[model samples]
Target: MTTHCDFGASLNDYLRDRLVSGIRSESAKQKLLSEASLTFEQATKIVLSMEQAEKSAAALSIGRPERIHQMSSVVARRGRFDNGAQHSKTHSQTARSDNAGAAWRGAGGTAKV
Candidate 1:
């Protein structure tokens, strides 16, 4: 499971460092940081958006526009107002294997149940 804060802080550091060292642009870094500082969660969201944008950019650069679009659609669908995607299982399937009914003892393919 990924946390918004963990990856967000990492990304924030990354983009800031890259822009500062690689481009030597204080204005750009300040602008980005300021824009993302409007709310408490804005920074994390901006970081996540930048990460995803870079991923899509890489995919397009590699000539896989369809894959980027497909992945985007999946994200959009998952972002919709629903939690219907779930792991399916029956009641019996939920039992712990160690505590369940015993299996047949077999010397070969044939065995007594």
Candidate 2:
């Protein structure tokens, strides 16, 4: 059978309501527990969490991204890349025979493999 229908409420709200109804069923509870490797208590929590996450996703998707940006602060970092610059090494950090003084270099030692 084929069917098409739209909910009067948001998609997330509809999904959440459906999840609540399914979670109330014994078969749904057992399936959730076995499939998800969860206890009855955990199944209930997981169902509720999925419902809430869908609701939040729907809320975010339906709203304009720009308006949401104004509601929160976002910080980003960008580094300056200098093609011609050479990094100076400190005098005391020269490579040592014992490999103790050098931090970043691979110890030129034999591998068992």
Candidate 3:
């Protein structure tokens, strides 16, 4: 209706009413309707705010678990790496101790401290 015709003085009211009625969200519609007087600009602002809030909520709901999963996987990998490092360190110490023992035995147990 706005494309082909002009409402002149009633244009703002008509646009505001049309926007309030055309929205799919019942909560937004109710909020808009509760207002005694609302302009088209006000309605658009309310709708945009509501839409952004909903999008934010949806992104958090979907993204939070994935972020947790990624963090957990990183922790798991770090744990495995730490365990492997510990094992390698123990093996290296054992090999050094064994070499020292061999050196002592090769000296007929008379190696100086």
Q: What TM-scores do the predictions have?
A: 0.28, 0.28, 0.51
Q: Model 2, which residues run further than 4 Å from truth?
A: 1-37, 64-113
What global local distance difference test value does model 1 have? 0.56
- Per-residue lDDT for 3-110 in model 2, tens only? 256644455455544554567556455556456434445555777776687789888788678766754433212224534568776655544433453433444454
lDDT of 1 by residue, 20-106 (tens): 445334544454556733443554465566667778988768957778899789879887554777666776675544223333223
Query: What C-alpha lDDT values do all the predictions have?
Result: 0.56, 0.54, 0.83
Off by over 4 Å in 1: 1-28, 63-113
Candidate 1 residue 68 C-alpha distance from true site, Å: 19
List the candidates ranked by TM-score, beginning with the highest.
3, 2, 1
lDDT of 3 by residue, 50-75 (tens): 99999999977986888889989988
**After aligning candidate 1 to the native by TM-score, how far in Å is the CA of 90 from where it should be?**
85
Determine which window of 10 residues in candidate 1 has minimal summed lDDT: 98-107
Q: Report lDDT (Cα) of residue 7, candidate 2.
A: 46
